[model samples]
Target: TILGLWSLASMSFGVFMGRYVNTEYMQSYWRIRAAGSGLSGVDAAASEVASLGDEAAIISFTEGTIVDDRRTIGYVAKGTIYCVAPVMRRAMPSAPVEFWAAGVGCCERRSNFDCGSARLPGGSLTALTYTAEGDKYFAEAVKEAASVYSITVGKRAQRVFFEGDPAVFIDDLWREAVVAAILAAVFHFCTCIIVSTALQKAGVRWVGGARGLLPGDELAAEDMLLRGGAARGKDKSSTHDHLRNVLDPRASWVEEKPERSCLGCGPRHYWVFHSLEEQHVEEIEKQIWFSESRTLDQGCDPSFFDRVVIAEDGGFNEVATLMKSINWYRYFSAFLTVGMIVYNICYILKSDAHMITSDDAGGHMYLISETVIKPPLDFVLRMLHIEGTGRFNANVVVPIMEIACLLLVLVWVTVLAVEAALVEPRSRRRWKNLSRVLFNFPPAIAGFSSMSLLHYVNPSVLIEHIVEYSHRRASLEPVLAWTKFVVLRLLCLVIGVDAFLMKFRMTAQYINQEDIDMRCVCQLAGFILQLIGIVPVSIIVRERLLRAFFGGEDASEDIEEKAKEMTYHALLCREMYRHSQSDLDFVVMVLSFNDVDFQGLMLNMNSSKMGPRTSLEVKGNAQVTKKNSVEGRKSLEEDLENDFLEVARAASISKARRGARPGATTRKPREGRAGGGSPPSPICP
Candidate 1:
């Protein structure tokens, strides 16, 4: 069995290795083919060039000259010049050579009428200019030019070229293979030993051990098999035949011994044969007994059970027999799973509310009023049933709720961590547990804070503010708005710094760790939070204003340009978010730059849209005439405006179809139109 299992595993590994080898071979073959093709092309060009003249004479083929071969003639030249054909000369016109030469000596050269003769080398000398028959000849010319400058023809071959070191590249690969084979052998030996020990513990024996069976033993085993029906096997016919042989005690068990021996040893070995035979008999017996018990427990023979009970004076009833057994642990686990889900949902909702109420209310309210006039605060108003002006108390209630939720989430996570630590098996060392807790703690805190923040900050409110702000401004450019965003972000930084100082002091008292200061932790957390808060706000502000002012085309173009700039920003954000232990200050510095860039994008967008327009006065007569064409210009502008509105409407529709928000619900077709299907029945009635 062990040998069979190992063979199967080895076969799978072999197949994977074969596929890898095949892919490598194919790639190498293509690379070699490409190199050969390139070399051949270069050789063909060199051969053509050599055919023009003898080695020494071919070198002196300067100034345009026709080389006359016995069969053909072709132009040979050494100095290059701009070659233009008669047809191309007119279509794509170039200034006369004299015109360029005239400018070299300023006015003096033109006055003397000797600009070309004085300025140009080889003065007034002529050369044959050949026009190719088609693009093919042009392509050939390019190839010939490239081959003339080939590095392979000019540079000396390296010392390692002819006497190559096979060991240089192949040695590592050879060593790796050797190491892998050794590791595989060790693993196989260890696995086999484990299997052998397990088999002995299970009371299993080798094939040759079957002879110790008593006379009626085979018949008893056969009866058990017959009662249970045929056992499952790789081959159904073999299973039936085995059962039949077991049923007949007189049937020979000698035939089974040879096939049951270990793969490493031949069946001729006495012990190997005996071990295999005994193991087969043991397996059959176990299967038969297990099947019989299952059949009895399933009440397959109800009448037989009743007769047995009457004989034994034990009462039986249909109701008592019909009760299905239940696994209580499964039910308990399911209950716990459901409870955990509910707890998480409640925790998330509460956390969101806390964040929404605290720092985000002002921005949230402003946005909500712009979009909806009166946005619902479900928890504050609906849950508490507080109506009227009390609904506006989110500003006051949100911060307290946020802080409370953050505290609760922290405690909850801590409790969970402690419980996990306690329940986990003691096999894992203490240091590993401490490392896991410490590494995971910050994210857990941040996550809770993030959830709280999400509830309070309304994205729609922010987006609306950006849009409104953009409409009010004249410039509507990204740069200026980005500057304003930077200033506002700086203000946020100042506030964060103050909060950090206060919290650091409070945290120090709570932790009571004199040596391990809380200031570091507070500073880190504050920095992270500030980044998370500022960056997203800047992006949101910038994106909205860009979209509103520039329209889709300009926005897309700007985004593509900015995407390259933002890659570093994204990396810094990742570093901060992960809180790498090394170079904390460096990471923070990088993050601060990204923060500034983000703020700049936002401020630029804001100022460009919000600032007053500057009008320029026309001084030139041509400019006055251009301005005088007002009626025509107004008509063109109106047309453009109408077209833009139509485009916007179309884009909105497309956005909706692509599953943007406000169009998330899937629409159902009418029954008659939906393949003649019946409509779904309503549950309300």
Candidate 2:
């Protein structure tokens, strides 16, 4: 059971990891892209700052402008400007005046016009500079020459880097995965232990001696042998003795004296014959008298009728019939459990109608507006509280529903564990009684209530936390994947073990030969089917269908079945509650009885019929055989013996089976029917 739970947890974790972790790649890419975009924004801010003359002074001049004019702080020649600083002293040599003058004089003075430098008070010479038509550079330069440079600046450009660290995020993700996996494993293990203990207790109850026949309770062999003779004797001495005598051999006296009935006396010549006839008649009369006397002594009294009726109505057979009726309830319960399991599987697969979004609504709305002027599936959306009116969000509702579904599944698993522990064969009465006690534990209700409370307390915040946690722990991808794989393997192992144990336990506990064989076959077939991939497929399919049909409620049933499956698996693997041949026999006897005093009756029978001598011999032989078998068959037989011994000891048996060699034969009994009329003892080979 633990393994199955682990597998399921692993699967859930894997799915969560896959869906959420894959998003990280996209998140990372866009984050870097956003950073790059922010850099472009900084460049734009710098250009704006430069254009506002926030970093440099700007001045401008026109061609042929005099140096003395206030607007003529600079001179322009050949479309170039020569600007002088106001506070500068000696020629302002860094200014463009000298170069501009030289160029103008060399080109223009030699041809037609005389070009001279304009003198400034700062001792700087100004002249026309080179120019180009439609030059934005010249326009920019003129604007700069006239503008004042600002020393103080406003806000600096905002810079954005990648929002988070990839290494740290990956590490956190890995840690989360490991923690989740470990928690899942621990939970599974604990659950399995609880379930197994509960089941074993139940088994002990069902086969407890309190409910079965004792050895002394059986009818004595001597009594059974004498009952028929005593009954026959009583029938012969009844009020109908005359009629009975007609069919008796002792009535020959009357038949031989036939002539005596016709005459009171005989002729002298035939006196001898007459005397003989009279003698026969007298004997016949005496015989009739004796028979009549005995009839009075053994008369048919009214009390006999009462005793006969009581005998007819009471006995082991009646007890057997009553037991059969009681067992039907158990069978019914088993069937109900199976049905519950199936129902749970169906509920988990249904999709929430409320999860639809605007993206899905667009095409349908467009078509509807062109035709009926109404939306398709609008009723469904409204019913799900998701009509795109911002009243409810699919992002929130879907996750909430998913968690609820998971909780439901867990609850169902608990239910299944309870049922299996209570119902499956073993110590049935004890288990049933324990089940009654456990019914009040209320774990399922408590869990559901807890979950509901959790849901009610700020669902959005809860979702955010979950998302953040998942994101933070995304790097444990390998661990999550590996956990899932391990869980699956464990599930398979559990299934195998459960099937085997159930088969063994049932076979041992059932009294009816046919039932034992049938159970064995069924278990074997189930195991084979599981091995061939049918069981897992069936589970998956059933879960899907159940989820689709019943929604959340079915999840409980799924959990129950899975738990039940796992518990049995664990029990089988652990070889717990296994029975020895004698223990098995005792359990069968208990299950077969209805009366409370059945065990006592069995004890009585065993004491009287199986004498001390025979008992001692049987015990001695068993011990020897057990020892031999244990030694000879070290692998198979030893394991089988060990399992049997464990069950026997648990059942509180007085002695263990004798170890016997495989090929050894038993000695023949003396003073018994020819060729030994008894059948072989039903013990494990």
Candidate 3:
């Protein structure tokens, strides 16, 4: 119930916030600045700034004397860099520089303030301020910087501004979240429909109140009533006459037409009719009563059965063995995902893990790990003194995306495992609702990666700032590079997992051909995308890493093999036949269910051939037999037309009263009869 509510809430939240975040917040944050507007003039128009919003141009400079001694740098939580420099608007030497100009990424240290030609005209320019009305965090960073420099900034100048726009780096986070929500809804809906249809087909109405009466049982009752009605409608002749007419040679013969058997009835060899002689009717009734009693005692659904066909003496163990192997591989894949999660987390939290925090506040950064442990790539590149070059920007966006992908894969794998193991309708029904929130990952990953790549390659202000920021931090470049490579490899792994699951569905037959085909097409498309965008890149990256680290002679061969393995094509090809065999085995098991003895025989024969994962099938068969045992315990009234115990009780009571009467005539039995009076036993049909 919580999961369902969460699913609904997540979708609603995504759809609502996607447009809200982009239009309301982001739009307010980044807008075109009109030319020739002075900083002082903009400050004077602060009253109208709220109404104007993004439409008002705030990129203006204040003509004032720069006080570099009072400059200080501060950072926001996300590592945004800011500089607060005091500006004296008055020309008098006695005037204090109380007006502080906040500039992003313009001060490397507190003492050096290089914001917008301040030395040229002693005037500082502000592009965008941190003191946007409603956002207090950025203003705090600027305030802290001012405090560090022993300057109390005026209320109007508390805002931090940047010559460059960080909005260029801002991603549409809500849009991706919305897409994920919608995808989850679609998957959930499909799973529910498929599971519901399967339940209905099995004569179990999970959605309705009726539980005991099966479709087959109802049909059998209807057949019995029709036969009884026909018997009552027939004219009755004298027994002797009826027998004589049947024995006569001139009696007409009617050909018996075949009738389709209802569910659980199986096939019948002999046919019965209402128009029959007295003797024949009596004999038929006796046989029918015996058959009904036997059927009920056995707790069988089929009222009648034909000869059982023995299966050909061939081994059906291949599928079982193959499924066993797939299960091992599945577990291995799951382990790999877990390892990836751990590795990713370690990388993210590693000491000296370089993260670009603030884009423009003189390239402020933070070390995730307190100790400075540089990666091999960074260590090698450090000799070049790349800090001043401003070449590569360290970003956490792609890493965040990778984390999302990891979580998706983990959930997908877990759900797949749970679905395979569960047999109970109620348990599965509940799981089905929860699984609807699991969204498809490949498309979502693709969308996010594409956006990330676009940001990485484009030479916008944000990208430039990031590059400069990364260059300053020796370890940041390698970390970001390695993170990208990891993401690619993860994508390849996800495609493999999808292929594995697709095969699993094929074997299970839980879904129909069309659904399978659609899934296959989507998976194929995703695989193709992976090959195009992820695999080749991964191969190249792998090759470079190997060459860089090992410089082995067999690097090319290793790369090729690893690349093939990464896509999981080899695994798919090897297991394809096993999946087919599993389907065949499933068909055999289903067909053998018509004969209980043969079903048990097949189950026993194949039981040893299967591994642990196939135990669910054995468990299912056990549950069916258990259900039959339960069915056999039905109430006495359900099995008999009248209460036989009452009749027996009444007979015994009357006999006792007669024997107890005063002066009752009692005729003793002759020499052969030695027993006292005994009550008749109850006759139950």
What clash count does candidate 1 reach? 43
Full-model lDDT for every candidate: 0.34, 0.32, 0.38
For residues 141-209, could you state the per-residue lDDT of candidate 2 as single tens digits? 334433533111113211111112333433454555555656766876787688666544322211112
**Candidate 3 positional error at 375, Å:** 48
**TM-score of model number 2:** 0.15
Please write out the lDDT profile of model 1 over residues 321-345, one tens digit for every residue. Answer: 2112213543454344345334443
lDDT of 3 by residue, 62-157 (tens): 444334534556444456565555544435423333345555566765567666454544334444434333345446755666567555544444
Better of 1 and 2 by lDDT: 1
Number of the top lDDT candidate:
3
Q: Looking at model 3, report the run of 10 residues with the lowest lDDT sum.
A: 204-213
- TM-score versus the correct structure, for each prediction: 0.19, 0.15, 0.25
Name model 1 segments beyond 4 Å from true: 1-8, 11-242, 245-403, 409-685
lDDT of 2 at 512: 37
